[model samples]
Target: MASVLGPLQPIVDMVTSPLFLQIVLFPGLTSIAIIGALLGWLERKLTARVQLRVGPLYASPAGGILQMFADLIKLAFKELFVPENSDAFFFIMAPTTGLVLGAALVGLIPFAPGLQIANIEVGLPAFLAIITLSPTLILLAGWSANSKFPFIGGLRALFQQTAYEIPLWLSALGVIMMAGTLNLAQIVAAQSTGWFIIPQALGAFIFLVTSVAEMERLPFDLPEAESEIMMGWQAEYTGVLFLAAQGPGFVKLYAFSALFSVMYLGGFLGPGFLPPLFWMLLKTLIIIVLIMLLRSTFPRVRLDQLLRAGWTTLLTLAILNIGITYLLVVGLPTL
Candidate 1:
């Protein structure tokens, strides 16, 4: 028996390795999917509370916590409907692309020490590049539908992402300057002295606001404004394709929130009470709750207003943040 099992030892070790666990279990697809589903239910429940109504109670006995999973199951079994004149290839590819990119971005994020899938040197730039793919995929999704509303929605998405991505990149320069490395782990390590949120408050604010826009949530959800555009670029998708398209947004929300925690909230650096991963997760949940609250409390803004704010207000703030960071790092020498 020992001789027979000796040859399989390497395979067993490979399967149970930390890297494999990181990729398949915690801080990976399974965890992200669970979190996304819970967030969906949480958003509805919280919003319903604010609106003074019961929401999704019939889906499960436990305050409708299982509603999102139920919906996903229903969607998976439902018939897939393709538009008659739509470009079938792009239509199918669009959502798949978004889901892939979203997962890739999540994989890059370091949840805790030695717990990341990728720890590239140019992580920040690579992250920004991956985020830019979302808008392009949205455009493809809308245009491939060959419908009026979806096309309009795609154009709006393109414009919105283009406007906000500038400030998003500029805002992170403050952290990059202070940390002096694009590697996320190094950035977190540098925050041992203090979290960047203190001195880089302006940049942090810009990042928070632009992250909302990046995820296309609440007030920034002009592209998918259901009241005005009838679900916008997602109008033509059904069944699994719809899941592939819409599911990534929630995952991206989690990814962005985690990124925010890492960049500004000091990643996993905390008192040694629970664990590094626990602290990271706790901070992420707090940010997620804040975002959900924003969703529940705020109304969607007009496209023009969104554009103007992104271009003028956000851009100016990002510039000021960069200047302030430069002054502090260069003049003070202690930052």
Candidate 2:
């Protein structure tokens, strides 16, 4: 085995070496951002399909693949309209803050075996900490905008964040309990026999649901409900600022999906025929698709219902999941 791995070791090194950090960071960020923007386009197209309407077909013949790019270009060159009443500093700061923080999270996640930018011992906790700041940034953006719609959107975002963060962290604790480590790579390795989805099925379910809420996708997207609040905190943003804010949403989705893949879907594990990076991307894409599907199928829930589901239903389920996993781990003998 040592001899066989000798030649292959260099390949691994080449892929994971420090010099490739730029390669990993840029392509990874670009790919994730593109996927997320595409997800928005996909959601529109898919929702249109469901509702029997055409969606953005004129942008490009290849089913509007260039639509997102076109939107990006437009947002880039379009003039930024900063409201007269707005606090120019934070108004300028908020969207970029959200985007930067969201993109920073990608650095902490592992893509495959020996393929990660940083592998801190407290990686999971670090990821949680980084993501928890998003809502505040949105709030700042909304408040700084000094507009009624944006302020209301900011308030809604604050409430939504408060409600969902608890369940999200609790669900994460369930995985921690089962895995016995905070390290993401270790957690992934612990699933050699079977994915956590089987033994901790309930936790996995809660995690998925709460994570979607955390991502502010459909059914829990009260913060940005257009009819109620006119795009919520982002109502005042336009042009590059709008694009920056939009960028974070995708980054967050990619980060959370990657984290979920690590926690439950046997991250980076696959047969010899396929590379580890391929497996990791495959798992992340699967989760992303499921999220998109949920967005397409479910109607947006009322704010009160969203709160109830998060605090009552999801919290109860996550707690029970941890209890059961604890009992199983304690009772079972080592093989």
Best by TM-score: 1
- Model 2 lDDT per residue over 1-335, tens place: 36567778888877776647544554356666777688667767877787788887878878886788889888899988899978989998988888878877877777876677678899998998988888888889989998999888788788888778887888888788878999999999998888998888888888888788777778777778887888888888899999987778767888888888989998898787989888888898888878877877888988788777778888788788878888878876668
TM-score of each: 0.95, 0.89
lDDT of each: 0.90, 0.82
Candidate 1 local lDDT, 1-335, one digit each (tens): 25456888888788899888888898788888898889888888888988998987988769988999999999999899899999999999999989889888888888888899999999888888999889889999999999999999899999998779999999999999999999998999999999999999999999999999989888898778888999899999999999998898888988988999999999999999889999998999899889988988899988888889989999999999988999898885563
What value does the lDDT take at residue 214 in candidate 1?
89
- TM-score, candidate number 2: 0.89
Clashing pairs in 1: none
Off by over 4 Å in 1: 1-11, 332-335
